[model samples]
Target: MTSAPSVLVVLPSLVAGFLACLGLIVAIGAQNAFVLRQGIRREHVAAVVVLCTAGDLVLVTAGIAGLGPLVASRPAALTAARWFGAAFLAYLAVAAVRRARRPERLDPAGTASGTERASRRAVVLTCLALTFLNPHVYLDTVVLLGSLAHQQAAAWAFGAGAVLASTAWFTALGFGATRLAPLFARPRAWQVLDLAVAAVMAALAVTLVVA
Candidate 1:
């Protein structure tokens, strides 16, 4: 027994959802790093984008569909997520720091298509782990988006907007990174990017633990 939301309310909800999702997903993280790398390599870029966008869509849709309240009701579940996510992020941060120290440049000649590369299964599995293992993904797409979506009269519309935002962001990140291939051709550039990623992961790990 609910009526449709007015155009004003619906438009605002859509914009809110889009902006919120963009704000959260735009943060540099493992998932984004993989996508950017694949884009730069021109290897399985489409697959990575589709996988990430699909994962986010499902999480956001579920959040809007009422999973958010159930998750909120379970404090223990959130605690477990926080612990696991913090641990994983810490590990990734350490790994990034280590990689930064080594700083191997991408092969300049490897930009062209090559038969010998990361297999489809390997790529899929890696992206899946990067998406699912991160508790922040759940917190952002589920808890945060869910809580906000419910505030709107048309929650489904909000979720749709969020999905669109995710699609746009991943597409851009995966496809746009290739344009920077020249910059990343240098080992120093790779080192700088890895160091920045390490910093971001470390900060996120601390935030998760303290949150």
Candidate 2:
């Protein structure tokens, strides 16, 4: 009798891959906070959401397609990534501190005409920088996820499924938070959010340094 077709191999792998990928993504950080803020502000909501999700997809694809092995093989590259990521987090911490100190003017009148445009650009740039600049993202998504996916029964299919999970999670977060913009309209709320973001960035920086 012929052995079972290789196609059967993909089924179990896909499930394992999805869970592994989701676990890595659910951690809240500067990136997720920025996306949620854009959503709450209703500023470039669609563009910011799509850009973040799409960027993750690209990185996930790169990781699965042998880039993981390349990075793992290069000790210098990984070390550079760690330092770069730490520095970027430090920069974010400074920005967050500045926002926290700024005076809050809640009235729509205080909202500049170019606010949305600027926010849109900031969201895209921040998402890309957070994803690509930091070494942790590469280590987690590329090295960890890629390596784990390959070990599964159907490596390629599992990796693709995991990438899809990442896309779905970010998209949902971006759009879902936008619907709550009214709650964030208050100046105090924005201040709190800014402070919280600053704290998170600082903590991430510390973690990077210690790691």
Candidate 3:
């Protein structure tokens, strides 16, 4: 049985963990854009959300287990990640550009034709690459959040809160994005979105190279 006082002490750390994770994740990025696109298309939303949350869970757990410092110490690894991530992002950007040139309309059901839809394997691979290939993901979860977790009295509790935050965020983003489906029914809307996605990916790739 836990005492009230102990519970009180744990609550703040938990809240802090939640807020910290939310701050890190609730941003515009390649991963978010991919999820949003899939959601709007109503293609494999649940799988994408689950994989994203799971990736975060694994990274955050590694961070909490004291791998954060070791990761931070290895600048070479991060540089390697950045290069690979930049190349991947560039490839995605070009693909988005090509997609924009051939925009397809969404049906009333918010799904494209079967012929136009990507295979589950392709989507899964892209989602995994977007989630894990980025070095910022490492810095945010492993180095930054891990260090922050250690600052709290109950590190595992903090990690739990962080994981919960990630799960909630990805679920909301991937699922909630469907609310904009009607607006995206037009082919022009999809073209604009693909162009926007291309721009963002290109900019991020440039930033990675110059950083």
Best by lDDT: 3
**In model 2, where do residues sit more than 4 Å from their true spots?**
1-8, 103-119
Q: Residue 36 of candidate 3: its Cα lDDT? A: 90
Show the lowest summed lDDT stretch of 10 residues, model 2.
105-114
* TM-score list, all predictions: 0.83, 0.85, 0.94
The Cα local distance difference test for each model comes to 0.83, 0.75, 0.91
Model 1, runs deviating above 4 Å = 1-10, 108-119
lDDT of 3 by residue, 1-211 (tens): 9744387768888898899999998988899999999988888999999999999999999999999999999999999999999999999999999999998877645354622877899999999999999999999999899999999988877888998999999999989988998888788999999999999999999999999
Clash count for each candidate, listed in order shown: 0, 0, 0
Task: Report lDDT (Cα) of residue 27, candidate 1.
Answer: 70
Q: Which digits, one per residue and each the tens of the lDDT, describe model 1 over residues 1-211?
A: 9777889888888988899899998976778877887887677889999999999999998898888778778888878878877787788789779978877666646553322357889888878877887776887789899999999877887888899999999999999998998887787887898888788778878987998
Query: Could you tell me the TM-score of candidate 2?
Result: 0.85
Model 2: per-residue lDDT, tens digit, 76-113? Answer: 88787778888888888888788777624333333664
CA deviation > 4 Å runs, candidate 3: 1-5, 108-115
Q: Which 10 consecutive residues of model 3 have the lowest summed lDDT?
A: 106-115
